[model samples]
Target: MSATRDLHDLGQSLWLDNITRDMLGDGTLAAHISDRDVTGLTSNPTIFEHAVAAGDAYDGSIRASVEAGKDGEGAFFDLALEDITRAADLFRPIHDKTDGVDGFVSLEVSPQLVRDTAATLAQAKELHARGDRPNLFIKIPGTPEGLPAIEEAIFAGIPVNVTLLFDAKQYLAAADAYLRGIERRVEAGLNPQVASVASIFISRWDVAVKDSAPEGYKNRLGIAVVQQAYVAYLELVASARVQRLLNEGARPQRALWASTGTKDPEASDTLYIEAFASPLTVNTMPEKTLIAFADHGKVGEPLARDGGDSEQVLAAFEAAGIGVDALAERLQQEGADAFQKSWDSLLEQIATKSQALTA
Candidate 1:
């Protein structure tokens, strides 16, 4: 059996972290789904920008949208909705078969609106309606401003993929917002089966401290952070609070490992993949990383529910003068800034493409 299948059988959902029109048009995406056990995928403005800028694959659609008098976000979302809805259809079977536990496609909201709670929620609802796919998750950042939006989105029965969380506290805050939404639904006599996932970024932590950490602890911080969050995840899923929601027909929001590709060349190619093998969660891999893991990856024991040695590992970092809580906040802000930059660039690219294609 393929290692991807092995990982799937290990009870973790393996999701593709990239998407493009070319992949959808060709058999590449279909192949990944069939042969690589990729039940889901994710996309963002940056990925879309890369796909559009890489070639003329989207020229025809871009021209059509441009000619139709659509511009900027509307035009861009038109293209994104087309691509993502098609991808979502391909996974619809897996989604239904799993009873909605797997086979999800994520499309991120405008990173430019990260600090605007009302706008974020509005756009999230708009995108969710535009996609019109049950398994299509509208990704909202798990920032302070986004927490309220996350809750409101959930209460509205919109599935969310809470993105850019860096630590257990952030994850739990997002989780609480999700819980509040579901609890509100139950109280309002609505279906409480809203699906969601809190995506925690890994590998970036190690990169953040690569130059400052001890040689022996070169690639351990990221995994330690994930371990710490996983402990909280296990606790949340087992808590009486979540149990009460389950009784109300609500699905527990899953914890997803994002930014998992190894940044350190000296680290194992499958470093994050191997360390993050846990059931009831997800690991969204970049295209190459997914292929690499399928080629020669091994799935051993899963992550510790109690977060074995995480406290000790984090203590070591603390002693080294690395304040993890502060670092997590800084990393999250940095990540948001990076995504915003990408969003700005992508909008410019879209406008340029629109003009060029139509002209």
Candidate 2:
């Protein structure tokens, strides 16, 4: 069996961290589903920006959306939803097979809404309604401003994929917001089984510390941080609070490994995917990383529930003058800013493309 299928059989979901209208139309995404075991996908401003700017693949759609009176962000979301909803439909069977746990395609709200809770919540509701696909998850950042929006979005019964979490603390904060949302639902006599996933980014950690770290610490910080988070995840899953919620029919918010692609050319392409091989979590890899893994990646034993040497490795970083807490905050902020930049560029691309296509 392919290593992709091996990971799936091990119970760790493998989701593609990309989607393009061309791929959807050409059966590329379908091939990943059948041959490589990719059950779902995710999209963001950067991904969409690249798709729209790459070629004339979306030219006809852009012309139509423009003719239909859509412009700026309106036209972009219309274009994006067209692709995301179709991907969601393709994953619908896996979604049904897993009872809404596995198959989900995520669409993020406007990154500009990151600081404004009300705007974020409003746009989330709007996008969720606009998509109208049960398997679609409207992504919200896990920033301080975004936590309240996440809780409110969940209480409002919209499934969420909480993004931009960098460490266990951020992951826990995101998880708390999700639980609070479920609690509100149960209190109001509503269904508490809203699906959600907290995405924790890897690789960026190693890149951040690469220059200062000693040789022994190279490419290890990210794995240690994720291991620590996995230990916390196991504990949370076994906690009495979560147990009570399960009994109340509320679904658990699963952990997702994002940014798994190795940025450093010297490192293994499948570094993060192999490190995070375990059940009950999701690893969303880039197309390049996914293909590399299928071609030759090996799945090792599952991560130790005790976190193995994570604590020790982290202590070494601390002793070497690295502060994990402060670094986590900085990474999340930087990630949010990067997405906003991409969103701005995406809008510009849409406006330019629509004009060129019309002419």
Write down the TM-score of every candidate: 0.98, 0.98
What lDDT tens digits, residue by residue, belong to model 1 across residues 78-103?
Answer: 88889999999999999999999999
Kindly report which residue stretches of model 1 are placed more than 4 angstroms away from their true locations once superposed. Answer: none
Using lDDT as the measure, the top candidate is 2
C-alpha lDDT score of every prediction, in listed order: 0.92, 0.93
Q: How many clashes (backbone atoms < 3 Å, residues ≥3 apart in a chain or on different chains) does model 2 have?
A: 0
* Span of ten consecutive residues with least summed lDDT in model 2: 210-219
358 Cα displacement, candidate 1 (Å): 2.9
